[model samples]
Target: MDFSRTHFELFGLPTAYALDRDKLDAAYRELQNAVHPDRFAAQPESEQRVAMQWATQVNEAYQTLKHPVNRGVYLLRLQGIDTLDASNTKMSPAFLMQQMEWRESIEDARAGKSVTALDALSDELRAAHRRIEAQLAELIDAARDFAAASEAVRQLRFMDKLIAEVGDVYEELES
Candidate 1:
């Protein structure tokens, strides 16, 4: 259990976008069992504190590796790239136009209180999200193109927020 290891290394997995969820889950459980604070309760105070730290690190690593978007961003970070930095806000014009269209559809659906329209939009957005995920897998795993993967991750971030908004709309409609 090396505290300095990256999330992938911590999980004993390859540092690639495509990962096996079952293996990750197994590794997480194994690490958690080893570093759980309760395992050190009978030890000295210093040992307990160290166990707590390891527990925290393992939990954080698990979370980062569990999500596809986070995994992609973390992979880029390992290569000295920061995808969330403010200075990296360059998106393609075609994508910007698509965003505008999606926003307009969302606004229209909300204004009309059209559940059907919202449902259709949600399906479309979900399909888009799936397509982006496939692209990310290719860029990060097959191509090993971090530069393009960063852009895909940014696009994914947008889709995530939009999906959340769609969920909000669904809740509003239900109420």
Candidate 2:
């Protein structure tokens, strides 16, 4: 239980994009059981405080490793890269055009109260998200290409926001 270890190291998993969810879940459970604050209630005050810190670190590590997008960004960060920096806003032209088209479709669907159209767009975006995930696995796991994986992470961030917006529009239409 090294506090200085990265999330992947804490979970005893390889430092790659493609990870086994089951392994991560099991490791998290084991770590939580060991350091959960409640387990240290009768200990000395200093020990309890240290346990609380360990609990916080474990929870943070679990969260960062649980999500695909976050895992990718964290992996890049380990390599001294910052994907979320405002100045690092360089995406491909093709992806930008695709994003614009998707945005337009979402706007049109919401304006028309077209749940069916929104449903179609939701399916399309999901498929695109899967494709991007696959690309990220290849770039990060096989090629070890952090540069490409960084772009994939950025694209994934956009897809996540758009998907949430589509869900909101659906809720509005339903109401």
RMSD of 1: 1.1
Clashing pairs in 1: none
State the lDDT of candidate 2 residue by residue for 1-73, as single tens digits: 5789999899999988889999999999999999999999999999999999999999998999988799889
Which ten residues in a row are the worst by lDDT in model 2? 1-10
* Best candidate, TM-score: 2
Worst 10 residues of 1 by lDDT: 1-10
lDDT scores for all predictions? 0.91, 0.93
Q: List the residue pairs that clash in candidate 2.
A: none
- For each predicted model, how many residue pairs clash, with residues at least 3 apart or on different chains? 0, 0
Candidate closest to the true structure, highest lDDT: 2
